[model samples]
Target: MPNDFLSPADQAAAEQQQRLLAAQVVRHDQLPTTIRTVAGVDVAYAQHSDQLVAAAVLLDAATLEIRHTAVVRLGAAFPYIPGLFSFRELPPIQQALAQLPEAPDLVICDGQGLAHPRRFGLACHLGVATGLPTIGCAKTRLVGSYHALGHPRGSTAELVLDGEVVGQALRTQPGINPLFVSIGHRVSLATACHWVLRCAPTYRQPETTRAADHLVNQELHRLLAAALPPAPDGM
Candidate 1:
């Protein structure tokens, strides 16, 4: 992929980096007992273009009120590689997150972490780089298989891959689809799932993810509209 920010790496080299990073992923607890502030990170891509927008939304964990938000427009430096999506998305996300007024105690990623094919997903990548507790709260499974969970909220099933437990399929709302929750870094899998459910009281997706998604999409649309040429007056 054509990248302006990072150096090019072949598949073998990239997977090797994933393996090394996987070893550094901390699945144990490494955070404060109480999480007052939470953050969510997501990226939205412009159709058929490398242009993209990333957003970081920080919220009051108790009230789900948005506290701070940061958004940035930039081009991705890597292709949509299956296990290495962090390379394409994290640069802009990290930039936006760095601009936040206050760093959140915990970060929820709209992607995978330990549930990845390499066990090193965007959440892990960002947490390690930023030294923050992170959780991967994916809308869909990136990898792993799980037995069907109960239909009621708080129901959970183990997500296992390669005969190892990596994450959970959790029901956040009654009769709704389950979320794929996993340990990113500095947080245990159980804590990740607990936070995800706590942040998602009404909706299926956590407030952090919803807030960041809304911000990124709004920013991307504004940018696209601004890039449009003026319409001819005589038409």
Candidate 2:
């Protein structure tokens, strides 16, 4: 698919669609008692081109070891609207997910969930689209405010927005910046926080996220390099 650069009218319609679909978000724990495998999803784009890569990496939930990885290259399907990123990123991500050998027990998205202005972020959209348990583990806060957190790991503070508790600012590593975790779909905030912490035993970002990011970045770079003309006379 190519970037459409949706018209203002189309963008309005898309926002409306998001508002309508936001009602479908589950916001509870509907996952299996024992989560065997967890997948992380992320996207990377080629500079000066519509080409983008989406990566889905399935990891052993117990050990955070990579099990299966899928990467798909495609053109953007929608414009680069700030809050409407899922519209542009989800199509390729869904393709990558389908490439996986088996559906993951749960998914961790590298974006917001309920912590968006409209309360529907990439994680929420992905969960509803695939009917899978998902969590949003973002590197930064999208919408909400929280008080200071402890330097020790596992420290957390409520992320409240518009008088509602939308998510939590969780400290995954000691003395490191916290991650914004929110309930995407079919999971609770506490459970989401737990999984984020479990997947990120040493780093600020989860293993699933790190693996998927690596895959997408590598794929994007490979594709771009292949597209470049051969160096003149092998200089």
Candidate 3:
């Protein structure tokens, strides 16, 4: 990735671009009747450096077993803007996805989707660009408010932003913090929640997200270690 850091003027232009691209996101379900495979995508950044790694892990939808994985290391192309992170993360993620042996039936993004200020989070951007049925299962809320949810798993509350229902806060496991889920593209909110719970049979986060996060962190540590200077002969 090239560090084409956006100027102040360019950042405004990028924001406008997000507004335009958000309109193209498909809100309804356009996924296969039965999703056989799902891909999870996540990004990891190097401390004090633009270098980052993106990983995509494909899993059997039913069994939640890892099927394939791909990883790409690259530099951030755009400046770190709060709401414009997609511009910085999308390229490497797409590169990783392209390396997969087969296209996944669905993609789960470990970030926001429609639950964004511009309605164009990384999940939405990736979904629209790839025309894939995608879902956003974020660990934290970006720009939304939801009522208190039940303690039991599967409980959910509508996430409202600007007086509009954009997503939901769902409890994937009993007594655990909820995940914010939203429609990325070609998926409905209800359906998105359903698949998220299914993928997270035993954890707070989906298996897809967990697997992808692990892959990126593992690879990042390996790269950092390899780049480190050799230790002294006798410390």
- Ranking the candidates on lDDT from highest down gives 3, 2, 1
Candidate 1 residue-wise lDDT, 1-235, digit = tens: 3232233367777777778768888899999888899998999987777987999999998899998989998887788878878888888888899999988899999999899998999899888878899999888988989998899999999999999999999999999999999999999999999899999999999999999999998988888778889768895
Pairs that collide, model 3: none
The true-versus-predicted C-alpha distance at residue 28 of model 3, in Å, is 0.5
Provide the global lDDT of candidate 1 against the true structure: 0.89
Give residue 29's error in model 1 in angstroms: 0.9
For all predictions, the C-alpha RMSD in Å is 2.5, 2.6, 2.4
Residue-level lDDT of model 3, residues 1-235, one tens digit each, is 1323222247788888788889999999999998999999999988777888999999999899999999999987787677887888888898899899999999999889999999999899889888999998999999989999999999999999999999999999999999999999999999999999999999999999999999999999999888899778894
| lDDT of the candidates, in the order given | 0.89, 0.90, 0.91
Off by over 4 Å in 3: 1-9, 233-235
Residue-level lDDT tens digits of model 2 in 45-75: 9668998799999999998999999999888
* Clash pairs, model 1 backbone: none
Model 2 is weakest, by summed lDDT over 10 consecutive residues, at 1-10
lDDT of 3 at 47: 77
- Candidate 2 global TM-score: 0.94
Q: Compute each candidate's TM-score over C-alphas.
A: 0.94, 0.94, 0.95
Q: Give stretches of model 1 more than 4 Å off.
A: 1-8, 232-235
